[model samples]
Target chain A: MQIQSISLSDSLILTLLTLVIYQSAAWAQQKSKFIWLNPLLVTIIVLIPFLLLSKIPYANYRLSTHFLNALLEPAIVALGYPLYLQLQHIKRNWKLLVAILVLGVILVVTLSFSLTMLLIHQKEIAIALSLKSVTTPVGIIITEQLQGDSSITPFAIIIAGFAGGLLGPSWLRFLKIRSDIAAGLSIGAASHVIGSMIISKDNPYQGAYSSVALIICAVLTAFIMPLLMPILSVFFA
Target chain B: MKDIIYTVLTITLCLVLGKLINFSVSGLPASLYGMIIYCLLLQLGLVKPIKVHKTNQWAIKHMGVCFIPAAVGVINHFELIQNHGLTIIGIIFFTTFALLTFVAVLAEKYLANKSESSPSTSNC
Candidate 1:
């Protein structure tokens, strides 16, 4: 019979390694030449060097960390409380919220496919790219609907989230935009939950609205994408 | 201390209820359903409402800690991006512009209506 051992020693080793690598990347980030490459990117840089030297393969690393990522769904659930606090704001601004949701969905689908076909000629890639603005789950759904390759959706979603989160605040500042509602919604709409979390830190109120708007946008984007993909297919083809 | 615990308990209950509803209603987003349910609970007195004070302060202060895991995932894809640099850049550019514009216009209009309806507060 084959069995697996879940030992304290193994857990301790993993903890120590995660800490060491995490801290090293934090340190390197302080000195990295490129300003846009943040600590997340630093972790990736440190990981690449270690990934080559270590005997542990990518699958093993994923197995060790899968539990952590699994926590994300529940963490998403936890966001409900904060969102609840802003329920009053939502009710007060229902019309605006609805407008934003509808418009945001149309814009995301239209721009995503249009830009893809205009720049790149690949229809599958264009359809796959249609989901780049959405959160992963809905993005994957849209990707599947368009008959696009599923493997690339996660990468596209992650990059989209990272890009949105990273540039969101700066763009607001650059444009002299100073509305918490706008900042939070844009961040959440573009980046998903992570961007909303970042917005919550700075401004809780918009975080609440944006949190709602983010999910609404995701659902709407998913529902509309399947219909829109075929329309774009003609142009890209 | 009591409030923090209360908030935690409320949040946990909301998650469970949300997950159940999400399972039943596959079309609606789970988190949205949970948020709505939690809001109803708060409104109806089943869940005690939290006063956004000290405990919330802590949550807001330490939110960056949560981003660590997601950031790690981003690292693995650096090479794939390296080859498709232009496409990635182009997509990011257009999406960011589009998202920002859509948000700014909608929010400004919302805020304008809000201010006209009631006394304007610069609080936000």
Candidate 2:
């Protein structure tokens, strides 16, 4: 995939550029009471257009920003610290949490797949939509495995994340779902890290549950999607 | 300086172990494995939390920044979004909201009942 090698200086500059933009967006989010000024969303919006206008290929941008991407794995590992902190809470409710997560995965995949197939009738997009609730890397990988349009997978994931981050807390509140575990699990299961991050600011306990949900949903979707897609396809047809 | 090195080594060890497991098991991400492994290590007292505390905190706090590159990759698929943007958005919105409601309602009911039955277990 490395079609053209980016120079060392260019890569460094791009890396620094991403950090600056991301930090600024994060700062904006911190100062303002708006949800749309999400750091990840803002960074993507600003960088995409900047790259396009500058006639820079997406490949170059990706290559330049590879350092940030490399940190993703460690960032994921970092999540374990919070999960560890919440171990007692998780242990107490493992059975219930597992039951909810498994059910949530089935519910999300079925709803998304059926809706996409019913409306668009495109198998690839349907497959991508079914896995959008999981983290981006897992979703993309599963989408590819299911013969979906992998390119659309990330976009779908971001939209799902944004939707969950923006509306999840308020929606849950309106419904009077006051349990931190419930809020965290639902948001984490449906929105992944984005929702988890947003909720964590309000309550760390909710964030921990959200991260737990994120990990479990990712694993469940990876294993279940491959087996379930064929069955869903048959049912849809 | 010593703390930073210790943190790096601990995380790297987990990542390497995760990668090794991933080599054998072909589905889940190595990072996911690393997360579980890291948690287990903490549980077993194999890795001291204080050693990795600073790094882990910083990483988790700013984790959103790491995802920007991949999200921007979406730009490559403008045609896909242009073609089915509304339908796709609708499906995502509907399904996400439905799942959120379903999970939250069910979980909330179960949790409330549990707390009522055993008040001691109710932390929040």
Candidate 3:
């Protein structure tokens, strides 16, 4: 028992060291080809292999990082400051912002799920995929409400964010979509927190609008998505 | 001191309202409830803005750490990704492009009409 406890302690310390090392490396190499990936991306890449190699159960790693997750609430509250700064612009365009964001949310969620179901033919998986574009917390809630299989939402949100960050701006450029507000808000809204973070780095105004739009749409979708699920389920068939 | 106190109070109220709404609505998520209430309170001036201090700025600066738990979550479901990776990636790509296109067009039309009608703030 003593030896096992010592080994666990050693592994735990090593995991923390690994996390810190990779995180700093990712940050330092921010200008390199590694720029395409963020710290979380780096951590995940390192972690998955470590977990698989050591055969450490994920629940253990999650237990170690649970404190970090608690930070999301305060982080979201901090977003209020930026939103406060941009309140004037948001107010001026409130109607258009609402319409566009809601339409974008509905269209993106609906179409993505439909396509997945047609392609994958798995009802539970499709339900999980539908909430992917929303923020992770809200996606988890929506997936639970819909009784989806438990594992899909988080992965879905991550992929959704990565996709949005990589393709969103290029798509806009391709189509000559020049309105920063619209481009940012739509990508952020569709991708949620991941996309919001990407926008924050590239353009503050787009980041601000997108962050607000994403949060608003996420809340709106949570309340509304469940209502449509039963009806929408028919289409999946 | 005053700013910290006020910020704490506001967040406490926000969380309390969130929990209350969660209890009240069996169907809705608590975070959404808290966020919507927070937005409404701010909009209505019911929750007056507290001045941001250095500590607040620091907290905001490192807010990305909050997602570590969620990021760590990806580790739990390795098998799913190994199997459905391509489909998931495809969905993210197509949905993002399609939605971005739609929003950009709508925004352009909206901005154009607003500029033409208002006759002021044309620089935007």
Candidate 4:
């Protein structure tokens, strides 16, 4: 029997190919700026076909991009910078910020969890869906800890992000909701980073509010899910 | 170049701190621990915000692109998707919209009333 061997350089090449595909797909959609047509969706759309046509295994592809995979953790650590920059605003409206953020986290997590659980009927997946509104790194960690399918967590996150990023602004207009802090906080709670970028481009206040929302929401969800799991297991039992 | 190295070293130090904390606690995620440590270092004035500004902007700008490969894991779970695809996507979409509406309306109302009750002191 012969075993196939691959080298670090080979993995590096594969990683570059994956990165290029991601970048190109994102660039192609940069003109449209449609929320649903986001770069994440585009990357998956384009990458899958290319993998099939090229006869490359998904595991092999993931291993090739192991470098980028490790980079994500540090990237998450870097979130501290944004939060630091925005800390002043948060301090200014500490009361309002705390009130809105705590409320937003509870509403988003509970609503997403119950809705997904009721609709899907899969316990693990319901758990995964609850983490949909968080940033990818946090979402992935929560999903894995809850024993959900980690593979689907990113796709779930993208879907939620597009939902809030695309439809949220329109919905705000339709509802006559005009406060920047409110709108920004809502989008961040529902979508996280992508939605923050969308809101930030038009209004910096909204973006700032949204960015803080991500921090609070992520931190709250992190602790909430772990504690909730044990309680939930007893109930499900 | 200074900014790049400073940011890289800062991140490395914070992430290492986070990893050590995680190793001891075994419950909290390391990145989050790193994030908190990063924030503390900044707040304590040990690391100047200006030092890492450029690298932070660059990383944040390209952050979305980095996560694309992670999503590709979905390709391996086609069977799972086929089983629960529509309901799952539907739930996520509907619930997300509901959440957005709820938060926006509530926050708007709160902020509006606050502004009406008092003249603004700070722009923020």
Candidate 5:
């Protein structure tokens, strides 16, 4: 048991060490278009494989990195600062934000699930896939309620956020979609918090909007997903 | 040191307020409640944004890294990913981009039209 605890602490050190090194590398290489080298992605890539190859079960890894995970809550809660910074924008454009969120949630959930059902023909999997764009905690709850596999959720949310963060800005730029509000809303809807964080790096204004959209989309999905599941099951179940 | 302590205490207070609200309405996520409470405190001048500014900025920028543990927890579903990874990737990819495109265009158009209609209404 003592040896086990030591290894666990070692893993914690390894996780932090990896995070700091990767973050510093990303900082050093900041001018490159190295999206995959994002600190979060790098940490996951380096540490997960290391854990697996090193025979450190994810349980131990998670426990070791619990401090980092715990920080997620406070980090998220602190988002209100930026959201508050854009208070005037939110106040004036709330109607537009709400409309985008409502429409985005409905269409994204319906369109994605329909496409997934057509391709995979698995109702549970399709439902979970539909909730992929929302934040993780809310996604887990909705997945549990809808009887979808929670395991599929982390994969879905992360990949969606990564893809959205990757594609969202380029598409907006290519399409000449210059509205910060629009850019932020889309990123938040498609990518959740991670996408917002990425966009925030370049555009704090849009990042501010993204945080608002992230919250709105999450709340809307939590309420709407369960209702849609029964209807979706009719065709796909 | 002072900034860290104040920010932590303020966030804790906001979280405690979230807990209080969640007690009455159990279904709501506490993080959202905490955010709303903090936003209100800022809006009402109950808390100075500068007091929490430095720490909050760090938290927001590094928020993605904080989610890594949860994301990497996907390892538990290795077989699922191995079997259906492509499908999952494709769905998240196409659907997210499609939604992003739709919102981006629609929102830009809406904001452009609104500004043209009444520039006075928009503060920024």
Candidate 6:
């Protein structure tokens, strides 16, 4: 468990390996009808064991794939394309959309925060848990702001995203929630981009709403969490 | 080729602007700022859709790939996971399910009625 410095050539090889595995996972997801075959989930399932067996430290893998991580910023910015396309719908029902997302953000934060505090009773873990529903970047930022363990935030986020991607649609169907708008917003708000990405493949309209939910929820969580954390901390304290 | 270049430059420019804004204001991620700025640019006609179309599509389509590195980093926290893994997973799963049900059920009620009252807006 010594952290080792990776060579540039090794980094390049790791980066290439991630891409190859990712592309294969993506293909498998597309080819398979199973909802659980999400590309991100599959990639993680394969890479974690691969890293463990190969004796490659997670730090080395992360550094090697830093370029890909950098692309995440641009990828998030690129989400604006879908957001732009959905402008008409967003504009028409912005008030309702905002209201729902605002309430949704508050609900998720409160629920996660209280549940973690009640069960785990660890304030740092609770703080990290509170922001799990938002995108990774936003979650990380808020986790740091609240003096929580930022490392735990991403893991919680990926799990939340994985759950949302795997079971969100089917769960919605079981609940008989048929509206694409509702489905998309809930998936996006609850699961973030990963869930929305999966839903979007089935219906672009839902995807658009999902992105809208994703962005709005991110903004709202950023605003709400700081103010709300102190208040919620009182209950647990 | 030109369009691709424009797309790259435009997204990079937006990200840089976002970082600047985040530096000054703080709170939100630079990427979120970049998204807002990019969305505004598209809305204001400063940036056209076609220019960024291909790149945006590719990025969104493969956005999951970008998260691999971060997710893999979770392996580093095995000790924490081992300590509270089941509780953590339970909280996430339950809360996420509750949030989804809460939002979706309410949204369905609101949207279903809205569409019924104003069928014209229902098409989207």
Best of the two (2, 4) by lDDT: 2
Assess candidate 2 and give its TM-score to the true structure: 0.84
Candidate 2: lDDT over CA atoms? 0.79
Docking class of 2: acceptable
> Which regions in candidate 2 have their CA more than 4 angstroms from the true location?
A117-124, A135-154, A169-181, A196-212, A226-237, B116-124
TM-score of chain B of each: 0.67, 0.83, 0.74, 0.82, 0.82, 0.84
lDDT of 4 at B8: 94
Candidate 4 deviant stretches above 4 angstroms: A1-5, A29-37, B113-124
| TM-score to true structure, per model | 0.64, 0.84, 0.78, 0.89, 0.78, 0.85
Cα RMSDs, all models: 6.4, 4.0, 5.2, 3.8, 4.9, 3.8
* Candidate closer to the true structure by TM-score (higher is better), 2 or 6: 6
How does the DockQ of candidate 6 come out?
0.49
Candidate maximizing DockQ: 6
Interface DockQ of each model: 0.28, 0.48, 0.35, 0.48, 0.44, 0.49
What digit string (tens of lDDT, one per residue) describes model 1 on residues B12-110? Answer: 676677678869866444554554666577677676555423454455333322333343444345565676667856786677568767776677667
Candidate 3 recovers a fraction of native contacts equal to 0.38
With candidate 5 superimposed using the best TM-score fit, by how many Å does residue A2's alpha carbon deviate from the native?
17
Model 1: residues with Cα > 4 Å off, grouped in runs: A1-12, A19-39, A113-188, A191-237, B1-12, B28-36, B51-79, B106-113, B116-124
Displacement of residue A91 (Cα, Å) in model 3 is 1.9
Residues B63-121 of candidate 5 have per-residue lDDT tens digits of: 65566666676677777678877988888899998888888888888864453111111
| Model 6 lDDT at residue B26 | 79
What is the Cα-based TM-score of model 4? Answer: 0.89
Per-residue lDDT tens digits for candidate 3, residues A1-237, read 011323556546755655585567556656564444656556666667876798666666555555565555554554454444445455666777687777877787788778888877777777778877776656765676677854567667777787777677787787787766666667777777677767667776667666666666776677668777777787755
Name the better of 1 and 2 by lDDT. Answer: 2
Across A1-237, the per-residue lDDT of candidate 6 in tens digits comes to: 666887999989999988998898779877885657766677888889999999888777888888988787788788676667756556667788789888988998999999899888899889888889987766765676679876688778878987987799999999999888888789889898778767777887777677778767877887889889889999988
- lDDT: which candidate is best? 6
Of the candidates numbered 3 and 4, which has the greater DockQ value? Answer: 4
